[model samples]
Every structure is written in structure tokens, then in C-alpha cells.
Target chain A: MIAPGKLARLVATNALSNRRRLALHTFGLVVGIASFAFFLSLSMSVRSVFLEEIFPLDEVEVVAPRVGAADVDARDALNDDVVNEIRQHPDVKEAVPRMAMAFPASGAAMFMGQRMPFEAGGFADGVDPAYVADEDFADRFVDWEAEEHEREACGPPPERECGDHYYCDQRDNTCHKRVPIVVSRTLVELYNTQFAPSHGLPPIDEALEGMLASMLRLEIGLGETMFAAAMTGGESPPRQVEGMVVGISDKAMPIGVTVPIGYMERWNREFVGDEAAEVYSSIEVVLEGREAVAPFAGWVQDELDLSLADRQGERFATAIFIVTALFVMISLVIVTIAAINIAHSFFLQVSERKRELGVLRAIGGTRGDIRTLVLAEAALIGVIGGLLGVAAARVGAAAVDFAAHRWMPAFPFKPDSFFLFEWWIVAGGIACAVVFAVLGGLFPAGRAANMPPAQALSQD
Target chain B: MAGDPIIRLRDVEKSYGPASAPARVLRGVSLEVGSGEFVALMGESGSGKSTLLNIVGALDVADRGHVEVAGVRYGEAKERALARLRNVDIGFVFQAFNLIEHLTCLDNVCLPASFSRGKSPAEVQERGKEVLGRVGLADVAGRKPGTLSGGQKQRVAIARALFQRPRILLCDEPTGNLDSHTGGEVIEFFRELNERDGVTLVIVTHEQRISSAAERIVSIRDGVIEDESAGAPAAKEAAST
Candidate 1:
């Protein structure tokens, strides 16, 4: 049983004797570990962005036939009974009914009667104001009134549309001053990418002022006389009214807008009368968490016989994660090959130092001591390589993130980092490296330990 | 030289190859050396003089024998026990001066102590310097074996063998690789060490000149010591001077 001090000294002496070999071993290992860590961190970062920034994990949207089997209108679909049935689900956090206006918003108008038209049609769904105040993402929302003097804090006021009452944008999900119209984030993205270029219009640069002086239009389809005229393209629906744009939400809202439920109730009462307008178009079901979505959606389909749509847009998120995971596996395969090289290098080293080992054995050194000495050298390599790999991975990821932000500023859902190296990742990375190194040294150590003293002494 | 024999071997036999056609190296050989006597084992090439030394040092095991060193018998002792006995009771100086090239002279000297249980590296290192000084190579303690001359390397090897303070010193043609002048110096140094330190010495060599310095010169032929009368008391008195 050699003392640890003596063993360490032996390991150090032998390891340092072949400086060039040790350096080569460590360099290959460092690159392998760095690539592994880089891919692992990248997958985790993208997953985090998908969960935290892209969509709320606990919500789904539902719709059903309104009034009767022949009903083709959203104004009478998914009424109070359907909303109540969904609310009874144990996993459901809230089942807010989506209220629809009798007519869609056609254009935006100023006090001077200047009308700005949207390139395509749109719809306006009304939602509960109280829900937006509670569940909204505050940072992404642009508030117009708080710093009226600081209007330039965001951008031009041509897009700043605030009403005296609540209006849910369903774009950024942040609370703002009340209005009658809300726009979805999908609408904004579509307008910039597909809509702007073909229509010869400038793409939206900032979220706050992009849709200034614009009229989010919808094809009217309500009432007997107005519906007939709208069907014939003779005249627009009589139940039309323009409302200002208000708050933005993170939800993947449908085509047009989101107004307050209270405003919808009042407008429906005045135009269509209470008996015909008390019905809702659809309902939004917010669940406890992602785990509840499956069960709740199952109940809605089986028991209620209603269609539960995935408004969360998680399929794109899944595809992104799967691709990232594939890359991570490829990196690990590279690390595996590098570890094999490490094993080969150690075997060569042991073979090269047979004489030295034999001399030690001849001087009362045991087989265990020689084997331990070799393993200790391997562990030293792991520690140094693991540390270097971690630093290189971090710096490498940061460099890529910096480049991405510089070249593509408008990248959708971009996070602060493209590599999220949490504490566990660091710990796991080092542990993995050490395990690989130990595994690499095992066979060589066994070979050295099993050698006969005479054979070793006789070896070149 | 009044103490009982430090090393005793009775009918020790060693051979290689198949039992039916064995190439016997030692055939029922018996010898004994008393305390503090420098005995030389001499033979021609393949006479098994080195084999005898290896068996005495516990580096090689006799095929059929009763062997004892420092009052501990071999064959019954476990391999580990025998290794421990070799570490503590016998020291070997090989012809090649097998100093580990990577280690400093001091580390090479301290090597034996590191293999022994209950020995601290610090204590071993401290004692290594003392042994190096005794062998007249204290100034080269920090120098690597590669940097040392042939004579210096031999001295370092001698120092390493003496580092653990073993009772018996076994040299297998210790001056085989040195020049004539360095060989003479090393042989004289060995004689002085045996006389002054009172350590038992067994030296195997082919040269009669080297053997003349020892108290007894026993020749091996056909794996047996020459004769019992060759261990006469008169030889001890003549070489002690």
C-alpha cells in the first residue's frame, strides 16, 4: 500500500516526463468535452425559450356549433351552457367564453375623418377584461398613457390606440388602457413577412407603432337585411363600429381583434337584442399546467363532444427541440470517439514506460501502486480538460449568440442566450469527463498491473 | 563474525523447461554464510552463480529447498510476506545499475521505503539523503539518473539498495557495466562498507580478482557449491584484515 503522497509524486513525475503526449491527450479531450457541453447547453436554452417565451403551456381554445346544426355564424356558437360545462373540469383553471361583436371592424378613423385600411380582412373577439389584468405578460406590452410625455420611449403615437375601457390585444398579453380592438402576434408577423412585401407596404419595425392609422377590417355577416346586403356585396353591415386598439397578449389569437366582454354585452344588446346576442362564439380554457391539457382536452372531446384546438402552437416547439436533441447526440458520439483515442494514448504510454515501471516493481513497488499511478495521471487529465472545455463552451456559445443578434435582430422569440449552461450542466459535464477518463485508463492500468516484474524489466 | 548464519540454504534446487527434460540450474545446492562476512559466488557463464544470488535475495524461488534469511524461512511465507521480507531483509544491486531515469537520485534511493507499509514519504526522503551521503553521492541527490555518469549511477544504485538498512547486501556483478578504474573503486567501496557497516554481503561475479577480496570464494559447477571444506575458518580471518 503506497502512501497517497508517494503515489501522487510518481504520477506527477511520469506524467510530466512525457509533456508532449499529455498535451496531445488533453487537447483532444478538451475539444470533445467542449462540443458536448455546447450542444447540451444549446438544446436546453431553446427548450427554455419555447416554454417561457413562445406559448403559455396551460391554455387551449375550444369551439362548438352555435344554436343549431345548420348554424353557420360564430355569434351564436359556444353559448353559456358550453362554457359552464368546460369550467366544471377539475384541471381547468378558467373557462372564459369568447364574445363576438355583431359586425367586424372595417377601418380606423381619426377626428379628422382620415381612414386607414388593412391589406386583408380581420375579426374581433371579445374576452374577459379581468383575465388580461391577471395573466398578461407585462414587459412585452406597450402602455400609452403612463408616460404621455415619454411617448418616444417606445415609438410614434400613430399606433398608440387607448380606450377608456379594457381591450385585450392577445399579442403581448400585457395590461394596457381599455379599447374595443385587440390584435394577435400572428397578425403582426404575417403582416410584416407575407403581407407587407406583396402589398408594397413597409414592414413593421417596432411593435408599438407599426399598425398606426390602420383599419383592421372584417367581412360583416350578421342580421337579415344587413347580412343579405353583405352577401350580395351591395352594402356593408349596418351594425359596424370602429374601436381603438388597446393591449397586446401572448396568446395565438384568431384573425382579427379582442374586445372586452362587457363592451361586447352592451353592443350586442343594443344591435341584435338580448335574446339573439347572449350567445358566445368560442371559449378559452386555461388549465393548471401542461399536464392538465391532455386530460382536459380528452374530457372535452369525449364528454362534451366539442373540438379542443391547440392555440399554444407547441408543435413547432417540439420540432425545434427534437432537432436540438439530435445535435446533442451527435456531439456525444464525437466525445465517445475522443475517449477511445484517450484509451489508446494511455495504452501507448504504459507500453513506453515499461522499464520505469519494472524498476519501481523491482524496488518493492507492488502491482497496485503502478496501476494507481497510471489512473491518477488519467484523472489529472480529466480535471484539466473538463475545466478548459467548460470555459471554451461558454465563450463559444456567447460568440454565436452575439453573432446571431448582430446579423438577425428580428429573429422571432430570440432569447438572451442560445446556450443555457445551468449548474447541473457544469457538474454533469465534469462528471462525464472524469468518468470517460477513468474508463479510458482502465484497460491500460490492468495491463500494467498484470505484467510480471521480470517481463517488465526485460521490456524495452 | 561470531553470529549464526544470516542466510541458510539446504539442498536448494531450481530448473526450467519440462519436468521430463528439465534444464536444471541449481542441483541440491547447500551453502551458509555467517553474519558480517563478505562471500563471493563465482562461476563461468551459465554456472548459476547469479541464480544463486537471486534465490538468496528472494527475487527468484528455489524449486525444492529449505531457505532462511534473517531467521525467516521461504516457501511457507505468502508471496506478499516474501516480498516484505525481501524489502526489509535483503537489498540487491544489479549490474545495470537499474536507476529509474526519470526520478532524481534521492527519489531512486527512497523507492524501496515507499513500497513498505507504515513508512511516510517524508521520512523515506530524509533517510534517502543520508544513504546517498554514505555512498559519496550526496551532492547529486537532486540530479536525475540520466544526468549522472556511470560511476555516479552505480553509487546511486548502491545507495538505493542500502536505503532501507537491510541486513544483507546482494550484488549480481555490480561492476559489470563500469570501466576498470570505476569497477575497482566500486569493489573497494563494497569491501569497506561490509567491514565498517557489518552488513552481510553476497557477491556473484565471473572474475577471480573480484572474488579474492571476499572472506570466502565458492564456485558453482553443475548447480552445486564446490565443497564443504571451501568454507574454512582460515578464509574469514584472511579477508577480515
Candidate 2:
């Protein structure tokens, strides 16, 4: 029955006397809250990691090998003929055909227990060199050394300088050019995870993945002079060149290495004859943006009536939520423990202030008044502890972000952050702490209320 | 000629510990305290005088009795009603002063009104300061009890009890902790408040010097009232009033 103002003052007066206890309770709450917040933020970040995994650049592929078709052969690919046809569609933004031609590349260096090898005949995707220069592309090729190596090549163009991405493979002085390929971010992740452990190789990040791609070199015949003689009767040998990785892309040819269209054309002209651009196994269609892709992809599937694969990006979001919810539930136990600590502290506080409480009762305060005063004290503690805990969690989350960015940059499924604190998380954390603290305060408040005023007053 | 008894008890009996051969604190004692009377209860250390005061003040229950304060009967009053009656109708001053050390003198005086609920904060503070001035501790209103001397503390205690102008003031050895001069001064002030303000004063004391200052004295032995005397001018004046 005490008024709120009086209750607050009473609570404040009593609480003000015990700074050390206040700090201790708040510290306990902070630990519980910070951990909960950190975990919640981590879960959000992790969910985004999976979402970005679908198409790192918001681009989905129109997969090949239709549901039912005849006379489809293994040599079929996303050829230029299919790319040109898709580009003619008014809805289509750009269609880039992806293909890889056999080429030679070799160079290896070990760093941090991993061999950074420039794969011979590096997996290549034929892309437009102009696309490689776009802002979205981070140069994966280490072209700074190309000019230095130019001075080291046989001589100038008149003297038949060995072309970029190629080198003399023998004492015969025959020179081959290196083809330029683009690396896929997905491949980098695969190498770090699926391949790194088995090969005794350490995982590489964006920088290291780019470095490995840059170091690669490839040639058309892998330095074989007999490639022309080994060709079909009318087919000619493709010019050998060193293939260098020029850039990395979001989506890549899933089956083979990537190279620019020029390399694919020249290789096909020599190895498969001039009719190489007729059929394609896979095609990638670019639409307007986030707004146009899903509809465009669906339209293509319906209009074209081909078997198209659209990776379900949001399906896993629900499953991840349930999992994250469970994790959040587990973290709530920490808050409960903090509440228990608060309750125990209140118990001791009530016992400590028994005589004072008795005096209050003797001076016209009702039993309810006494209980309310105690609970009010608890309420204040809950609020203070809850807010402090939330603040500490924010700091902890930032620390996690800093550490992750510094140490784990090449981690697969990377997002802007590995820990995210949404507004709900912070608000919910504070509310939960206060509720728990009040829950903890109830039993002791009741006990103090039920005590006989005379007996309590009689206590020294 | 005394006014109708505001506090009336009929055959009040109280005991402590075991029911069989219990140490009887009060036995079949009946007393009446009228409005505007200054009465003293005198007894030896184990005489149960304080118990009688506590019962009269609605602070303790009797084992067997019909007790009434301000027309609220003991057996019928709810705990809340009893508490409210205590707040609005009766006031108590214990030997310990019982002042909450954390609160300032004025706040201690305002404490009773905090429970009264209907009183505004401004009204409570104004009345508290007025009562403090009545006890001549108005200058020390903001000082905590711990900062006050024993006499100043007892006066502050009296001022707190006098808050809201209760009909009856029951003080148990209110001057018990003060030196003789300070104790005498507190007693004189109590007499003046009783005489001038017509506040009913029931004081329990063991000292004859203190008991003699009252208009009437009732002496108790064991658990029963043994003697009663009232021959003072104040009692005569109260009887005429």
C-alpha cells in the first residue's frame, strides 16, 4: 500500500548503503547478459553467412541437363551460341557463357603449413576481360611481376617474347603464352575446407586465395610440341600460353577452371573445330537486380521449360531460427542464475535490515509496506544490473567482431560481420534481466512481510 | 468527571512461554485512560508495566481480554484497521527512541504519514516541522538521529509520535537514556504538552521522581495493579475540564 514515491525513496536509501553488494550483483548479471548477447549476435551473423552462401553476388545460375532431352553429349557446355541467344531476350541483362580450356600452370610456395600452388591447367572460366575490370572485381592476378618478367622473357615482340602466363618448358627455346583465368570465391572456400585438411594445407583467406590464383600459369598443350601432330586430321593445335588468374567472381563454372572468352575461342578453334559454339550445357542469365532475378529465373524456367536450379536461399533461414532460438533458450539459463543470485542477496538483505524493518512497522508502516520496500530495492537492482549487463554485451560483441575480422578473414560464408546485435536483442536482454530480478525478489519480500512486527522489532 | 475512557480494557490477561505455569506478565488487569489525562505507570523491573502499555497502544495482543482503543475493539479490529488506528489515533515512544537512523529528524516525524496515504507530502512536512518545533528541535529537523544527543533524539522521537496529532501518546521510559537534567527537561516538556495541548499522556517509568511529575500514578507489583493515587493540581484541573 505504499506510494510509489515513498517506495522508491525507501528502496534508494537502503540500496545506497550497499554499493559493494550492488556492484557484485550487477557484475554477475553482466556476465550472464554479455554472454547471451554475444551468442545471439553470433547466431544472427551465422545465419547471414548461410544466406550469402547461395549466391555470393545475388546471381543464381540456370542449370543444364534438362529434365528430358535427347542427344545431349558430354562436350556440351555454356557455349557462346547459347549466351548470345539469352542476351537477345529483352528481360535478360547480360548472359555470360562459362567454359574452361586445358592449359598449363605451375608454381608453388608454402606459407603457414599450406602449399600455395599455381595449378597446371588451372580451372578456368572464359569471361570478358572488360568485366574483370569492373568495381566488383578485385584483381586476383599479380600483374606487377609481369612487367619485371617481361625484361626476363626472350626479348621484345620482334624477337618473339614468351607471352604472359607462359614460359619455356625445355632447352629447345620454344615459348608458350599463359592464358588468364578467373577464380571463384566458392572454390577458395572449398580448397580451404574440403581440400586443405587432406592435403596438409592451411586455409587461405581472400588475400591468400587471390595470391594463389595470381601465381598460377597455364599453357594450351602443357608445353607439348607434338600437340599439333596428335590433333585430328583437319584440326590444328591451339597456341600454348601461360594462364594467369586475373580476377575472382561470385558465381563460377562449377565443373572446371575459368578463363576469358578469347582463350576459349582460340582453344576451341584448334581442338574442337569452328562449330564449337553451337550447344551449351549450362547458362547464367543476369537480370535487373534483387527485384528482377527471382521472377526472371522463374519466367526463364517456364518459358524455356528447361530444368533450372534456383538455390533456396531463405528456406534454411527458418531452420536456422529454430536452432538459434534453442541457443537463445539455453542462454536464458544464465539469466536465471543471475536472478537466483539476486534473490539470495535479497534474502541476506532482508535479514540484515530486520530490526530497521521492525522499527518501520512500529511507526505505522503496514506489513505490506515493509514487503514493498524490500521489493522496491530489488527492482532497482534489477534495472541497474540489467542495463549494465546489456552494455557489457555490446562491448563484448564489438570485441568479437574485431577479433574475427583480424584473424578469420578467409572464413567461408563470410558476411560484413560475424556478430550482429539487433535492437530487439538489446531491449529483450534488459527486460529479461529486470523480470528475473523481480522474480528473485518475490519470495524474500513475502518472508519479510509475514514476520511478526514485535518479533522483528525485538531483534537487536 | 474524567472524559469517557478513550482506551478501555476489561480483565486483560497476558502471559509468556509455556501455557502450564507460564510466566504471567499481566493478570486480570483492567484499566481505563481518559482523554486529556497525564497518567504514570510505575513498577519494578519485572512488573509488566511495559506490557500493559504495549497492549493499550495496540502493539501487542492480550491472551484474554476485551480491549478497545478509540472505540475499535481488539477482538474485532482487522490487522490493517489496528495498524491504521495506531497511526491515526495513538502514538508510541519507546525507551530506545526507535528513530530510524537513516532518516532525518523531520523525515522520522513524517514517517507515520507515509503510511496514512491520504496526507500529501507538503502537508506531512509542514505538520512534521510544526511538531518538531513543539518539541523545540525544529532547528535540528534535518539532522539524522545519530548526529543528535541522547536528549535531542528523545525529543525527536516525541515529535515523531506527536505527528498527525494522535489522540493518545503512550511513552515507555521516554527519558530513560538521558542524563538527569536532560531527563527532567524532557519530562517538563511532556507535562507542558499534556497540560497546554490536552494530549492524553500515559508514561511508564520506574523512577519515583519521574512518576511524581504525572497527574496520576498507578503502581504495579508482579502482574497486577497494587495502588493508585491522584492528588495533583493538573488532575484537579483535568477533572474540572
The TM-score of candidate 2 is 0.66
- Cα lDDT tens digits, model 1, B1-241, are 5268999999999997799999999999898899888888887877878778877876667889899988878878766666676677778888888888878999889888777766666777789999999988889999999998899999999999998888899888888889889999998898888878888989988766577677787888878887433333447665776
- What are the candidates' C-alpha RMSDs? 7.4, 9.2
| TM-score for each model | 0.76, 0.66
Tens-digit lDDT string for candidate 2 (A1-460): 5678877777787777668988877766777777777788888777667766544334556656433344454345445655676678776776765544433333343345444555433344465554456634434422322333433436334676665445653333554444455656676667776777778776766666557544544333432334334543434533334555555565555434565566565555555556653444356666666566667666655655444454565446667778788877776887788888988988887887777776677677777887788777777877787788778877777876788778864545566677778898888778777788888889999988877666565525
The interface root-mean-square deviation of each model, in the order shown, is: 2.2, 1.9
iRMSD value for model 1: 2.2
Tens-place lDDT per residue, model 1, A253-283, is 5466666666666545545567535777678
Q: Which candidate is the best by DockQ?
A: 1
TM-score of chain A of 1: 0.71
